[model samples]
Target: MAQKRSIFEEVGTNEVSKPAPQGGLIEKGRKGARKGIRAWLVVIFALVMTMIAVGGLTRLTDSGLSITEWKPVTGAVPPMNEAAWVAEFEKYQQIPEYVLQNEGMSLSEFKSIYWWEWGHRQLGRVIGLVWALGYAGFALARKVPTGWHKRLLFIGVLGGLQGAIGWWMVSSGLVGERLDVASYRLATHLGLAFVILGFIAWYVFLLGRSEAELLQARRNKDAKLFSMSTGMLHFAFLQILLGALVAGIDAGRGYTDWPLMGGQVLPPDPFYIEPLWRNFFENPALVQFIHRVAGYLLFAFGVVTWLKGRKSANKATAGAFNLMGALLFFQVVLGIVTVLHGAPLALGLAHQLGAVALFVAISRARFLSQFPKSQSVREGL
Candidate 1:
């Protein structure tokens, strides 16, 4: 015989379950929102890289000063008709670069350079818009990871600052007898661009892994290797600024010979120009010589750093360093070719692209040294 249940006892009702674990994460590997944010960052990274290459081309083509004005809001709309084109051309003609260097250039020619500068500026606007929209969407939806809002916001701030710096650079060449922007200002603008790129890259790398994974991996970071790569990163940045100086003064195109300038280890009258200090920025021979020496030293230091990176226990970290070594060598070769060809438009752009690649590689190596990816037996022997 079966026992009868009480009327108050509901069928299939169970006793109280134990409380869930407290003071612990409920989700470890689920970070879809963060991953989406990283994907958006990758898009911005590609845009900024394209902007860099475009800016290089604009400089190589002698088109940087065509706009003669910076209209952050209204400049988005380029010349729409012939009268508008003439108005823009007349504005360019008033600048020293046109009056002294490009005098008698037709409206058509002016239009060509104008488009380049306009395109460059337009790209910047596009990047800013993309960032603003993406950040707003993520923030409003509460998708951004904790502590990331400021970092993301900082990029936008730097980007706006870069726009201001760009105008300041152009303004340097617009007046007086100067035909180009000051080398130091140019270097600042470029250096800031690289800094922004580095930050985005590092953030992207960090976001690639789950927060839990990063916390776990931080325990095994190789301090020495990280330091070495950090040094390499700074050295590489210095080299980039030097390269900008060389380009600013057309030094690369002047000295076509390797291991020598004008058939001597040092060019004649290294300080033939006035002020003595002008030779550092204005003297083609000295600037080229300094750039070459820096390149050599950078290569040597890179080899030492790569060797140290090889000793890292993590395969991914070692592989990143290896790529960095290969890129450094390739960039050196591209640089030599660029010099031999007297910095032709194509080769000059190629060399600049090479520098971009090397910078990203070194950054990646440095990042891996700090937050290495662990490999499992399933991944390799």
Candidate 2:
């Protein structure tokens, strides 16, 4: 028999050749400047938070109905002269809010609220412009990630929808005997804002790491913790919508008592409104009561979620949950303080910011659950 060549031996030139090494993670490398994209997203996120704060202040100041018109393009130029200001003020005088509430409000007083609403709309325009320029620049440069084009596009779509919804909300207060926008419409506007904020936050989290790394990390995901955090997120969103309802009718100011409404477990005339459904949105007592109960339930659920997150093997995830829990506690306390103080501008804004912080905390915790970072035993145990 002929001698058999060992596998390592170069038996002959005719031996089968190995194919060139196929691309490995080439797609991931081509994902564009993820860090750069993340920074851009962070900027947008901050602006959205600012928008929310400004919107809250506008509502609190009762400045939302001051504009009396939705001149998206031309309104950018505020009244520059006495004649212009007088013309704008005349339009405002025709609104039900002015007729019923501020029957003989002076021109100077009208200017105070006019500036607030104008600034709010102007900020919206700025946000739109920033998004457009950034998106166009990245897209033209071919720097946007392969799959992120649509994701980025969605933010602008929501922004446009939010504008329309804003107009719809304001239109409700301009006519009829109504002094404010429909509570549900206000809820819808605020809810959409949160949704937009949530998406930007999630996209930000995803962009923090490479696609390949994310895929690998996802394999070891703590499904249970993720599920719990998701529930917390949904509950928090519900609470936010309830808050909008409260603000819509000044329910927060209606009940300045804590742990009780009108000195009882529930308001006495909770259902005084003719239509039972109307009570939930119109009756200050019922709306505030629902908001208080929901707050308690949300805090309880958040505690349970935090406990579950603490048991995670990943140290970073545990820390994130810790932060989330702390913020949740702080928010609960702030809510009480806001109620006790009758939701004054300072306390109300603080409480709103607290909600924002808690929302972000829970979001980060939930994301960490799905894509945990590396944790060595030598690291904080």
lDDT of each: 0.90, 0.91
- Which candidate leads in TM-score? 2
Over the full model, what C-alpha lDDT does candidate 2 score relative to the true structure? 0.91
lDDT of 2 by residue, 1-381 (tens): 987778897666667888887765687557887788888889999998999999999999999999988999999999999999999999999999999999999999999999999988898998888889889989998899878999999999999999999999999999999999999999999899899999999999999988888988999899999999999999999999999999999999988887878889978888888878899899999999999899999999999999889878789999999999999999999999899999999999888878888888889999999999976787746
Q: List the residue pairs that clash in candidate 1.
A: none
Candidate 1 Cα errors over 4 Å, as ranges: 1-32, 377-381
User: Candidate 1's residue-wise lDDT over 301-368, tens digit each?
Assistant: 99999988876768899899999999999999999989998999999999988998999999999888
Where model 2 places Cα greater than 4 Å from the true spot, the runs are 1-25
The estimated TM-scores of all candidates read: 0.93, 0.93
lDDT of 1: 0.90
TM-score of candidate 2 on Cα atoms, chains taken together: 0.93
The lowest-lDDT stretch of 10 consecutive residues in candidate 2 is 21-30
Local error of candidate 1 at residue 230 (angstroms): 0.2
- Residue 251 alpha-carbon offset, candidate 1, angstroms: 1.0
